[model samples]
Target: MSADILNSLARRVGDGVAAVRPAAAMADSEATDPVEAVATALLGYVSEPGDGVLGRLVGALGASGMATALLEGRSGRDIAGQAVTGLGPADAPSGREVTAGLARWGPRLEEDAFARSIAQAARVGARLLLPGDGDWPEGLDDLGVHAPLSLWVRGRPSALAERPSLALVGARAATGYGEHVAVEAAAGLVDRGLAVVSGGAYGIDGTAHRAALAAAGTTVAFLAGGVDRFYPAGHEGLLGRIVETGAVVSELACGAAPTRWRFLQRNRLIAAASDATVVLEAGMRSGSLNTAGHAAALGRPLGAVPGPVTSPASAGCHRLLREFDAVCVTDAAQMAELVASVGGGVGGSGDGDDDAMTGAPPPRRLEMLSSAERRVLDALGTRRSRPIGDLVRDTGLTPGAVMGALGALDATGLAARSGEGWVRRPPDEASVRPGSWS
Candidate 1:
């Protein structure tokens, strides 16, 4: 961990707040964009300890884009301050005002809502990962102005940098095809020992996490809101499993809901934090495009899964392929290989690298079952227990088909019917244990 980097970030962030102190104070009173207010406050503070540094620094920032400069070895402090000054008196704070405000509200900025947000994140299981932390992915700093001040993380923090991570994002209203691709890709990525990262929204995100969990592989979900609040509501169970097996992460603190701005900002985090960003099924105007754009802007590897041309949900993906130069991926193996080789960095390899995504041996001659049998197995594999009607609906098979499947499964001792529901039998349970179904 580089203490210097953390210290620099803390100072830079603190400075940005100081630059916009007046606006922040106004926003506090008026209830406006406090986040922007804080960003503006820091304009004058990142300058070197001198009177004219702010003005000079502001000019340089405007000319060269100071955020990018900072990532490229320019000092964050000098660049931030000078850049604010270049905009002249109309745009930037005078040194006197900056100095005076520094004295009066300097302490207040430290106790501002932004600081409290970081504290709130800390109160949860999340750790505040600042730049220079061992867990900080150096690649993320490439985002420049959009780079996160700190990351709120749960689970193996080291995985942020230690593992090869791929972001799988798609529409919340994903189709069966999208969900299937997400699951297969996630499972494959996990089997290859890559940490799967996604938005943890619903549809594709939920399916991705569940598949990773099913494979017993590490997965992380980056949320736009908070770790405590699972958006879309449907994926609460899936989110719980992710927290238990891998991690649930966010840049925001607890109690923050997923707002439109936050959702857009959230895309930046997903892009900056991962080794590659893969779009599974995005609509024509899908928000996932924002993430893909961010990844491309940052020069990160970007992959998109091609879907049926007729599917509106896949429109954004095809657009990315046609307009944004994103690589088209069909499966996890291709995704992993493209991500590893695309960006001039070797993708991570470890214990699960050679593991099969199915986590089971390939179905052999005897293991191959009839369509009905396979349907029953698929249902059982997806959900441990289900009523006959549920199985019928899930498999889209007739009641007769379902019954026959269940009968064969029961005879083979692979499944059992109980008063509560039909369930996949435990491998070693000679007979149904009392209350086992219950």
Candidate 2:
């Protein structure tokens, strides 16, 4: 772990006690002295300095606006505290100055207990990422003071900078329409080469991840808890696949369990990291609404998939469209188009740009298949999978046409049957490499 990571861990520990207790665990402890409780907690880590490191650190941070500087690993600098405070501009440091500062502080912090705590977390599958690392999403910087000093990633490291990323958030106790919308939006985002980002909670978030993975598109699960202890425990397998293909990210250090406060904090990262954020379905009081709010606050383009007006699960999205002015997206093409209109445009994956469907060669072989077969296979490209019925409906073809497509899909190794008669196939590897198919 780096010094920036160590400082971030310390900050998260301090903030945890300062914030409201998690909703799931606040049983009649409201009468306790909040400051005393926090101080007592601090004692368990730092040796009792008269003024206390936490207090001094907070003061120093306030004076120098040291949060961003800390992320930059510029701790040893003696800049005027007034000038450094609150996202202020500064003289660019020479390469030598940066190198010297890191060289001095790196080893000292490495042996510190706080650093060890973060390291322990990493040992058990957690990852620590600062602003410049591969796992760091530049969008988080938009959070300003609320931005995490370092993100503690539980699952996939590749998710940090993965392109074509969009956030899918909604209520955990989602309605069937909400669930269906979540799956559709997620799969559509993947088909366009974007990764789906969401909190690894039960309802909409889980659906998004599952759909993205099923489509062979990347999906990122941003957790509020330590990576070692997957929250909702039921989604452990889902988290596993995300780590394999995308990533799970956080701001807390290792061993930091999930709490309600962390969930809100985690929301900011999801909002800021993506080029755009989509609320597939959410209730008026849904936690997903928090993410949507954060995205809008950051000036990130926000979208919602409309649902039945009767669904409480979709009320939040309706509110966004009605009150918050969120874009209404009906399909993947619009979602991708909206995301591209903002900054998180998808297509290239450090390999090559996504093929433009407009001028591509006419598919003679594909044309041989019935319309439904062609439609099903069309959706089964290099990223994700789709259900036969989804294809049937999406293509406006009959069930027989869908079935014929499935048969050709299996024969071509372009798709394979999976659970509940759904079929999935990743993009063909040969198409990605030169002359492989020939």
Candidate that scores best on TM-score: 2
Q: How do the residues 110-146 of candidate 1 rate in per-residue lDDT, one tens digit apiece?
A: 2245454544444555554445455566776765534
Using lDDT as the measure, the top candidate is 1
RMSD of each: 21.0, 23.5
lDDT for each candidate structure: 0.59, 0.58
Q: Give Cα distance to truth, residue 339, candidate 2, Å.
A: 0.6
Predicted candidate 2: what Cα RMSD to the true structure?
Answer: 23.5
Scored by Cα lDDT, where does model 1 land?
A: 0.59
Error (Å) of candidate 2 at residue 397 is 60
Candidate 2 C-alpha lDDT tens digits along 1-438: 333443454455543433322222223333244332322222222211111222233333431233334434454444233333522435333333433433322332322445455446635655444444544577776654345545555556656777767887877887788788778777777767887888888888888889888889888887776666777799988888788878876555445555443455567778788888888877665667767777777788888888888766677778889878889987777777777896655663222110011111111233244434544654453434566555543333445556776887688676786655555565465542111000
Clashes of 1: 19
